[model samples]
Target: MPEKYHISTTPVPPRLPRIGKYGIVDWREDCARCHNCVKKACVYDRHRQESAYLRTLKYSNFLFFECMGCFYCVQNCTKELLALTINSEYENLGNQYWTPEIIQTTWQQAETASVPVSGAGYRGKFAGRGFDAMWTDMSEIVRPTRDGIHGREYISTSVDIGRKPAHLEFKEGRIVSETPEILDIPIPLILDMNPPEFTLPRLEPFILEAVRMTDIIAIVDSTKWPECLNEKQRQRMDAYLPNIAFHLNSEAPEIPKDVLRKTRMVEIPDSDDALDRRAALREAVPGIVVSIRVPLNKRGVDRAVALVDQGADVIHGVADFNGNEINVKNPRFIKDMIREIHTRLINSGARDQVTLIAGGGIALPEHMAKALLCGADVVSSYLPFMIALECRLCSDCKPGLSCPAGLEAIGFDYGVGRMRNLIAAWYLQLIELMGAMGMREARRLRGDVGRAMFFEQMEEEIFGTLFGTRKQA
Candidate 1:
């Protein structure tokens, strides 16, 4: 067996003071100075840490709220002087979709590169919108030998990124068949380009460095090539070329033929003549994989089938930033769209011919696994990479306005380390999830509906007979 894949990580502290969920409110006027106070009994020693943090505080308006919310101090206080209060700043950290909890959890993973554990246990709803509406089966979790992260067994998370032949033909003990080139990435995740609002020229180097370290590919706009890279980076371009995928617009000038020849993969937007464009690029740059980016809207499923039938090496189904279908009031979620596309491809007998990569709402490690279960061969994300560097997602990034998170002034080492740590943490989680599900290969997990349950199906099966059809809100 090949050596196990492991991600080495070290602690990378956050740049700003943490906006923890709870804070301690002490009524000093009513406090009785006991010899042995409840403050000393804090298991986390939050009181002493708060005092130390306050003594050397740099920002005057920033409050200290690192309390663990154990409620031990509040419950055991003699004069009822201590109380736990929710921090308003924590509530305002992220918007509704990108919840504050998600941002904080991402920060913790990037800093520590460890699986997050909510000690208090899950307190949220059983089912909600998007990926939350699905659940994975953990029936095999009790098996001791299936633990992949602990080295008991090997679980492969590697995936290919090109066309795959359905079968082989041979005659006279010799095979004469053509096979397209394929690129194998260690993890089934890709680094996508950040949205226009979050784009930064200085950050590309760090992003490339992170991709190189993780042994994964990143999609970069081909127009920004050569010029955006430093002299040293330009010199080392060949070494990193395999880890980079270029994004080319159909109407834009073609990328230099030399660069395209050296690259392993290139992505083009889905257009009227997408198949023709793919054929042209294949003829121009042999051995280069071409992926068509299909918008995950009303026509996404049909488009994906058409591309696969027309010999596309890869079909990348993308949704809006929030994972919803664009310009549709009653839009289906990206997960549903991926499922529909996957099923259609299977029905059309083209499921094994090409790869399917899904993006645009994959915000967490679990979402990566869930996307594969919904039929994506691989998943891509960009927001978590920025969030690793403490981006608040203010949605106000523009000229003449100072970045609230100081992203522009971030150093290369810090940014790369944080992004690498986040990837390591996510990789560990993926292995752990695969082990628990009793699957040893990521390819086997693709479109394996038996290993997962959809909330809508369960709701309809159980309540439809009792209560008739569900009413629209």
Candidate 2:
């Protein structure tokens, strides 16, 4: 059997703010007192004699016991007995992304953070998007020595976020002329500004604050820098405005010299006017990098490369806003898009001179590394923030704009704190995931694409050759 996991639990106490929720196993009080019920099935045969449910009540160290909570007993009962409910008597297991059960054991130590115990237990879904869907080749799980972070094995997760020179010089040779600076970001994430309807103008302000706190960049929509910003916000904005990277329309006939002065980056949706706009914007702004954001379709990738040759330094491609691939015919999907671009860059002479950023479809923590492995330098997430703000992935943010948090209308102090906490939690989760993946630093995770296994590709490569592409046989 696989080794068990356990966490310590104290008797339910008062004054704690109820960090999380624990599930309660509620059985109908009307359970017929006389039935030699068929529901008393236990793998070890303990429940076969009946009345075994009595022992489960005062579970002091429940971690050591086997409740598996399979609900099999509930369904098999002749009396149609049993139900599960929230256990307010105990702390909750986890938060939105980290389910309650996962939080039961500290991800960092691989042991119970609260206390250590062991048992036969399983928690959470087998799969979900991003890293959860990934299995991370832990074939060596039983091998005591190869236990990634805990067993002293090396797993790398660090990544570089900005552009780099395509070529480098040798130390044996005298210094050849060094190439220009292609900026770098320590983390693989950049907060993209989607902007709230009423809180639109303050979007840049919040982004600036985020960059300040996290030491990462924020992608701002240049159009939202309206005049509604307060005096303090505007003054602070001037100091930060210089560092902020602005996303603007590359073909917008005329970009003001003043506005250009504040922006260090420009982005345009894929268009035929790429080269002309890149030149015009560069001539107007001089030191900023021009970027092209494309959907991860075949056509989009083609347009992105064409734009790159025309002097775009940043190539940003993305899948659907909901993390789905664009083309149904060649639906290798988002990561595939990154691989194609990475290979394209290696083939073209521009690989080093340009940076690649892929967004959309990054739902969970491990995806940051996955994208880099697929060859993107940086990735951004939009929906997760909405989730943090209590959006249940409802996607109505663009519709009636019925956010109760006034996320659509804010200058509120609590709003900012709440956002900070959410980001902090996400950052922590990212670090923990990277740690579990045996990746110590984010920079090392770039292009380390071999960490994941693609189900479709694996099946095609392994089964197709044998089946010889059977034609509906």
TM-score of each: 0.96, 0.65
TM-score of 1: 0.96
lDDT of each: 0.86, 0.54
Rate residue 75 of model 1 by lDDT.
Answer: 94
Query: What's the CA error at residue 425 for candidate 2, in Å?
Result: 3.8
Off by over 4 Å in 2: 1-82, 85-134, 137-163, 168-178, 195-205, 227-231, 250-259, 327-332, 399-401, 404-406, 409-411, 433-441, 461-473
User: On residues 253-369, what C-alpha lDDT tens digit does candidate 1 reach at each position?
Assistant: 777898788889999989989889889899999999999999888888788888888778699988887788866789888899899989988998889878999998899999999
Determine which window of 10 residues in candidate 2 has minimal summed lDDT: 106-115
Residue-level lDDT for 255 in candidate 2: 43
